[model samples]
Target chain A: MVKKYTKFIFFLFLIILISSVSYAKPHKQLSDYNFFKDIKNQIPRDETVPYKIANPLFSDYSYKFRFVHMPLNTAAEYSYNNVFNFPIGTTIIKTFAYPIDERDLDKGFQLLETRLLIKNKNGWEPLSYIWNNEQTNAFLKYTGHTFNVSWISNNGQEKYVRYRAPNVNQCKTCHEINNKIQPIGPKGRNMNINFVYPSGEANQIDFWHDRKLLNNIPTPLKRNPAIWDDAKYGINERARSYLDANCAHCHQKGASASNSGFYLNIDENNSSILGIYKTPVAAGRGSGGLKYIIDPGNPADSILLYRMLSTDPGVMMPELSRNLQHEEAIPLIREWISQLK
Target chain B: MKINKKIIYFMVIIFISNFSYGKIIIEPGPNAYDRIQEALILAEPYENIHLSSGYYEIEDGLSLDIDNVTLSGDGLDKTILSFKNQKSGAEGLLVTSNGVTLSDFAVEDTIGDAIVVKKANGIRFLRVRVEWTDGPKSSNGAYGLYPVESKDVLIDSCIAIGASDAGIYVGQSERIKVINSEAKFNVAGIEIENSYFAEVTNNIAHHNTGGILIFDLPNLPQQGGHDILVKNNKVLNNDTPNFAPEGNIVGKTPNGTGIMVMANEKVILEENYISGNATAGILVVSYLDEYEDDNYNPLPNKIFIRNNQLNNNGFEVDKVRAEPIALLTKNKAPEIIWDGVTSFPEWIGLSKQQRLILGPNKTKDRKTDMINLNLMTYALLPWFHKTKEDYDDYIGEGISLTEVNFKTKW
Candidate 1:
């Protein structure tokens, strides 16, 4: 009888094991990928590499952590202007966290969500994970979620934000090119700047080249997009970089908002295509009673500035991932438009 | 303890069974938004998502990217998707997949466009109603059934109201058919912009800024919109003051205008019952703004307006845009008015194929009259201009446009 009982317990254990393993779909749980050595602190595993870009998309003042993990014997193909073609089995991971206090990073942060773009044979598949309330681990959430977060601004003012985590299709809204899902960040021009690695400060391109994560790096990188808030860069370059990061993902040729006829890529130098004296095509109520998209020497009359100042869903530019206006970006864009003539 | 174990086992079995059946029916409750969205995300091709009849309070925008899926609800009034508290995303529901049909539901008070189908072919909207509940306001969403950069679209038995822009807007699309629809109390009841091969038939448009507009703007991804037929539509009483927010091209549409065609090609306005409009029944004009696109043609070409029943129109012209044309016609707007701006020089009026032809218009009380303002002469030299009241020279049997047929069955 004892032997029979032992066999029955073994069978139940086997069934449970199989059931649990089958239920844990690949990327269903954050712990399944083994991307981080420490979840709370966001310490990357040995195979993962951290990277940064020159101009980051504004995400309601959330501090972002970016990392990439490639399989063995595979590397990303470098492109001159666009995002690199990542090989299959490559995973790009981004974590969003709001620092408790903007003045100091030492004061703990509230981790919100982590998004993964996994490169497969079919194409890139996006999966979002919402962090638990106890900040232990994240779980797969196909339908999006919203979180109420509060933080202290740099000026010692308290602010609250209803941070939204986008669903899977919403990920494709900005990360789309030529009717296919693509990575918006990580272009050559946006990643050629110096990054402070754990070892030391080194040019990111050279660092990736040394690590063999990126292939075919041309000597002396030709261009680099400027950081939007950096005062040392030219005003034109800064303004163009801001637009390229924020709007060009959908506004350029063959993208979502291409029907609008306004292209804001960093390389688009044509004044007409850049919306100088250009009339709105389908702006609708987003026009804010303005005429030209960019009126020369008149920032107040420019629709671009007006849209940036709005929080209404119909009127706001970059219609996702941001609810509050980026206060720091307004003055710089205003000055650039004021001196355009 | 034994009963607890048995209950856990039962629940697991139920979960497994549910997954195997592949059936999803969503009802209203807390987290209904996520449940509905999850169903859409996880639905396979050719799956039908049945929404139970209930009022669903949606918080954010919903989207579907799965092809060949049908999202159906109980009925238009039975299943209400209200987005009055939408906080993020520009539109209420966005469909980016091909061969998708959305029917038997209503979306109300969205922050932006109500339903936007983009980059999708073989899309149909049937028995769907999109509206702002409080009535016409400039702060309402721009488009009701908005489809752009798409092809093979059919919108039938739909109703749109209180939109700030066109109630039913199809832009940069091809092969569209909008029939048996009603649009009221919106700016530009139905607008076909930068599109081709559209048939707007058997629709009722009233109490809007302008009834129907076919326009081709410059610098868009698609230009030179052509080969559209606006027939058998009831375009009447569009006398609501233009509540469109400023700086939109539609805001320039004169209030109480029946049909306006601008800078398109081969458009036919035929058999439409147009009456009770305060402006001209049919107004055809060239693009008035300076454009930078070299490939764009700013002149309306080959516009044929015939067999349309026009009555009680142009009694009170829109003071903003159409009053000046009325002043040119003895302070009275006619049944049809053409701006008479051509790409050719004034001496060489127009080739036979590139003319605005109108004739045989059925009138109720007054005589059928039309005029060409010859506004280009006034634009070039204000001192030299003459209005031509005779349109017999521009009358003929115009070329026929092919009817639009869709490949997908809805």
Candidate 2:
């Protein structure tokens, strides 16, 4: 019996080691899959499953479910419900799946995809899904909060409403505020609380696993890898990259407001040290009328937001190379502003 | 024969008396270059080339060589001098020859220097705005209102913003005055380099990387600048970050000073309210590399540093290697007494530190009045005494410690 137990334990240990090594490996090109051609051929022919919804007998409770067939070889469905009793707005339920082969359940190419069941007044609803061969741009645009789509019920009733992505901008902007731009997505905005997806699990992989969505999870990538990996960059790498591309290119000493002693160097520790966001009550021509310009949490009241939103060539941000409006980034910024606490 | 000749001369004189005076008005349409050029050459002096306040693309530089000629515009904001297609080797406006005034107009998006005036006297730039369309980091264009080697220039009430170099530069020229004008959002605002007899006053110098630098660099033959006074100006908050990669000399020194006096003589920095800078409030230094011999000389000689209130500020006056040593040494010693004489405790000799601690000794005498004196007998007391006894014994009696009774000739 002892020998048998030792062999069993050793076998389990070996399996765990092999699985960890495979998970550690970066994602490979999709062409490596022998099933790629079949999936590509099948994607165009698969009919777009119309969106569906179900309303139970609960009073004043409504739920929405949606599915989109994309040009790329991918499919997604999301569901959400308005719960009047809960003050936190809608509860979102989202799930994603891709075709796997049918064999021994553990060994099969077919896998039970990660599913997100966000609690609502009536029941659970899915919000978002991921597929194996998705077009990155189309996925970002369609899943973006700016789009309005139609959802049909099983009884043939259609409802149109706007759908939004999770507030990723809020997570990206603050970590990008200083020189080090670490997007603390899983970590809360305050860098204190870990973001556990509705499930009580603290670890992102564990949380996804508990939801019965993902069997193998990929490691998360940092928001800005190129600049953060460079050895010469110091301190707030992400914030520095954003500022250098945005504000500092025009707002530095000698370049523009040289007389005001307002050096916006990202490496500098104190924001007020260089008079960047300090109130310029009588700063002559360089002063932009608003008082206490960088008021931390208030982007609308802050002069920095006012300048970013301006279209005038003299007052607009970057002062060059921007041809299109960044409509999606606005809400993310608003969310970032709300999360300053 | 005489009558026939007279009749022919009378007919010839009568036919020669017919003429007409006409005026030509040239209006340049949008994107008109060839028509504007032809009109400029053909139109006589005092004739107007009325532009309709649209973007005018020109290749060659605009030169106003005629005297009393006016290049009027609809307004400064409406009319634009855009050089999008022009090559990089051209200036926006080249004004030479006297009596040229450009007013109420803007010259922007130029590839080269914005405005260059060479050897032009009596040049007036009133309410003239000059800028380039390149983002603030671009260095393709330099100088907003540039007057190089020109004399009797006046740049009044004009705004020069976002230039690669100084906003209003008066280089190698004399008798220039910049008043009631603003040059912010540029490399340097109103740089008076290698120029004499200029006044920079009552202007707000803020939000720049460097605040109000009067630099005298090495290797320029035109080195001497004197009689320049920087007074009554609010020079603050010049600690902004630098965007461009182009090297700046002022960055080598402290971040911002109200006035930086370097290698120039007879500069008066008085009564200016300067504060809130990352570095010193005022920096005065001589060029160390350029004039090696003069490095040891006392600068700001005949300078009056009196009655100026400096609050929350750092002040640095850099005297070269040789001059400030004696002044620094004399400041260390507290008290000096010559010709030792002692008798009383009140008349006791005191060391410099003792005198500093207790302050000056005093006494009172009663005779229906008060008389104060330090007698030689008081020297015996240890509390009030600071002098060595050997020096006291050497001098012996009847000599007052308070009085210097002898002198030494060196």
Candidate 3:
């Protein structure tokens, strides 16, 4: 009997050892902030819901993958600003990476970092997690990082950049509306496009409504701003929408560019304010020697087009975020301006 | 417990010794921004915050609330703080402390003003370079070295380029000096607006829409700026198209303008080389000509133009000039122009000394100083300048006014 008891105790000890190893949290956790274990390995299999964007923002030519999660019965309120007011317990995840090759997805990609914006009891909190080089678990970091990323461009040229990882407060730069941290994209207009769900490819708005992830669901959104790169939309609409998404955030009232008299928001209807024969206020060399902001029917003479085509730090529009000209969109803008008699 | 106390005491002593032995040095890496921010927070009076030479890609702009601190970098060419991908922070660096000095660094590609020193005292920007890098984009930062609503400010030996607004702008600041600087590819190269007791000297302002603007705007916290001296500056070319957004005061400035003074008093312009501007050189106008300001003084008073080599201006004149200004100066656009509208309806007994006094000084090798002096009954209407009058009657003799200088330490 004593020998039998000894064997049972040994079995119990073995179970304890296995349990401790499985639940081991090697990296430290921040107070009241939830972080994923790893970008590739430890994303919750069934708990977290993964989503994708249509017409993603160019991050110096980097690929992005997104995911979302919320507590049971929680939903988001849709607003016209294109930002949804997410309920407490909602979590949004965005991962920036580069696919090793543009042609293949199965070979896997290099995952750099993942950012989590969580809505707790107080307000939305932004956090950053940097992945380890060995593909291990990521750790929460207050300081941002930079890594050299190489990618094969559409023209088959090898491109490289030192990709920057944003710090916690940096997220608020784009996320702010009225000195408050808020989401920029993922609004009804931006998300009206199709997404591949568990069932099949369907409109993201319909999918969200069906899943009860959104609140105050309109049968159809009042207005849907089209994706700037989509050919389905008219050229004028596309250009207007593109300027709205990229420039209007800061160019609007009370934002940084408010001091400037020009407004580039999509909703702006004034033709002169829309830069038709409207002389530049302070273009400097941004004019590229052009006389006006936009010379109707003359795309080459338009300062807007000149600034868009330039990569000079002293003379480019939308002053930041791009070193290379959008090779495809330039022609569309040129055509739009050329046809505008 | 006694042993633990002794150990803690030793560590504290070492930590204190570390701070005294060496100043806070910040290098570009993960959390480098945070470390710099924390160092600013923890720094004592008269401490140095030195950033090493490298490219620092920060996500947000930085701010300092510390007093009496010196913030320096390895060098302007070597240390580049880029906010090219910044998401938030209105400016690259915002300082609201008293007696802050920044030097030998380049702030590149910010979304807003590159460096804004607001409501501070004795602020200095020495040997700093502020640039957009991509050049001349309307969406570039507004001001490069902006010191607004501050007192006793000095911006010396700085290089500013690629701003949508003024490159080296000092607004609403008292007792300020901007000297030995280079400003190019901006709207207004160096603008001193609504500030009292200011001096701008030995600076190069070129390739901008308007080189060197001294303005007194309305509806600002500070107004009625007087006693300004602009001397020994090279104001050249500046024929770039006006890229400022509509509705801004600078937006109305014609391309290729040199030394424009609007709605101020006791301004002395002397010993400056003003040339190659497409518009008239040394344009002095009243605020009453532009936007309406009830509380602000619309008339420019005690403006003394002395010893300036004004030539080659009005080569490519702006047709959009207010009808009065355009009609008054039609042929070859005079070397100097003065809009004769004061605040009052009538200038019944105003002499050349009471109004604008031109040239007790030199105009290069030219004998006659061409002047377009107007005596408009009403300042608001553009047609008043078009009215048939003998503007040449007021131009026979050019007088002089009292010269002002920086009496206070600035």
Candidate 4:
């Protein structure tokens, strides 16, 4: 009896040791997760769905390829107003790439980095992987990386950007809310649009619900945020959508920059909280000698427009993941601010 | 010992803790940015990360989010972290976790704030130096040693300089202690804004716009800052031009002012060497802005000023916010000036304990006086304004605020 009890204890200890070792080490290579059917071509594997968001956050104008992979037996809980809460073992992947030449469609692009947010028992854990020079595989990177790339713009202009991949803690700058790291994209309104999937064209939330990857989504989900460049939507809606994607992640209530008292979320309705004639509290040099955050009819005097056009470290909005100003979006924002009453 | 569930749990905790806690030493090199950040991300509770003495050229902002971590360096002058080419992130170094001790290092010339610790508890910054290297420019980052929305903050023996905003700024925090520090060439040196229960003593603030200011602003999560003690500090020669960028609240601070308290309550200012400030030695005023928050009170109430050596102040009145008061006082602004702005109709029902009190102020045998520029009357009816220079009306005992102590937990 004593020998049997000792054997059982030894076996338990061995199992515990193995589990601890496995928990300490996560997947080191991007390919280890195997969510791609064709890694180079960016094809999704089983239960891995490609998705798109309206008014996507800008990263020096890098084109983002996004996908979500869920565990076999689980699904994400639907949220009406906020981001969809995913289950444990869900992995949201995003690959940032810069085209060799934006004027030429057939030309190839350079994949810079792949960021992953994996939800486990503890909470959402963010990881970043940097692609190699050969563009074959990506390895895990904890600290950030910066590299220079030049690409011809769609309008036949030469553009150069020093791209930045956020470090682990920098990821929390936007993703962490109320002391918990969570997904920032895939809000209900942002994902309520139609997508051209491999199977067919359908609304993204409906597609997820049909595939059994989303649970308890209410019927007649009819909210749609604007695709910032789409001219069919009103300019105010488009500009608010853009600000919601780029700046609201940190500027909203209970987020990272709540101390500033400037809330730019889509739901924020108060004009003062939206930074109209709002005085800066701690914006030292970022103020740019401007008076109000949004000086109506004067984009040049608006601090919001000034920060959007600025590429300086402290003066820029969104504050991370981009070093260059988004020229395509700045004019739209400037136009919107000029029209503000 | 018999095998029990408690024993098993204890053994498991010990094993897991043994695998995580330790010391990590990193030397500066081309890869120090990544390696240092990686160590900060992976550090466990109670871990000590020692950065060896060398100059590190960091390209991006570094952050640490783990609790109970100690990030130390060789010395403030030895281990230098320079962010001259920082292309991304808001601040140079951001600390978001609780119980973090950052000591013995120097951070220089980032595009934004040098060091910002936010939403933390029990944070300590010791023997650290943050400088812009370019003296007092409008383009320099805001706060040097900035701690906001924190609790039990202790900043000791630090040196901050050349920031466009305040050098040592503690905002929206509680139970604070800022001791033995030196701040120079910043807009507002050593500021405590919208915070509570702070003891600021034994510091030297010089060559800045306003030395040692206590302010409370509206539209913030924390409001009604009160119960602060500013004692035993040297505030002198803060005649640097106000180099803060426009639209910042601190940009309104007049050059050459010493120890201004605005829109706060239950403040005690005592036992400080204040001199050589061209503006007033101490300015107590109300919040002068349009605010929409209904829960906000924008008045300085229950202030006690006593036992301070004041000299050579109010000689050259600043052209900014202090000009109107200087014009009213005929260019000889008193050592202490109070914008006597009070709530209407409510002031008629207040006791002596609820009013501004003035004890005996020890001066340098100079003609040091106190003035109340009836600003409330001026705002209501400018034609009927009266400036009163009397210390007898405010002579009374004020409430005894508890001193801020952090010896028990921090």
| Best-performing candidate as measured by DockQ | 4
Instruction: For residues B83-154, write the lDDT of model 3, one tens digit per residue.
Output: 888754557887767888898999999877899886677898999999989988777877899887678888
Model 1 agreement with the true structure over A124-189: per-residue lDDT tens digits: 889999999999899999987899999998999999999999999999888878877887788888
Specify the highest-TM-score model's number: 4
**Cα-based lDDT for every prediction:** 0.88, 0.41, 0.72, 0.88
Q: Give the interface-residue alpha carbon RMSD of model 4.
A: 4.5
In candidate 1, the residue pairs with backbone N, CA or C atoms under 3 Å apart (3 or more residues apart, or in different chains) clash, namely none
Task: Give the runs in model 2 whose Cα sits over 4 Å from its true position.
Answer: A1-341, B1-28, B31-52, B58-60, B133-135, B138-140, B243-254, B290-410
Q: Rank the candidates by DockQ, best first.
A: 4, 1, 3, 2
Q: Candidate 1 A-chain TM?
A: 0.91
The candidate, 3 or 4, that scores higher on lDDT is 4
> What lDDT score goes with residue A339 in model 3?
85
Which runs in model 1 stand beyond 4 Å of their true positions? A1-25, B1-23, B346-353
**Rank order by TM-score, top first?**
4, 1, 3, 2
User: Which stretch of 10 consecutive residues in model 4 chain A shows the poorest summed lDDT?
Assistant: A1-10
lDDT of 2 by residue, A1-341 (tens): 44434544455545655765654221232222221223322221222221221111110011222222222332121111111121121222212211121222232121112122223333322222223334221121111122233434334455443322222211111222222222111111111112333224264333323444223333341222113223454434433434433454334432322222344444445555333335431121111334434546666655555545654323334333222233433444344444443
Worst 10 residues of 2 chain A by lDDT: A53-62
Per-residue lDDT tens digits of candidate 4, residues A1-341? 44436546556666777876777466889999998998766788877899998778888889889999999978888886688888888999999988888989569788889999998889999999999998988899988788788888898888888888888899898998888888988878778888998777999999999888888887888668778999999999999989988999999888999888899999899888898878888988888999888888899999998888888888988688767778789989899989999
Model 2, residue B365: distance off in Å is 44
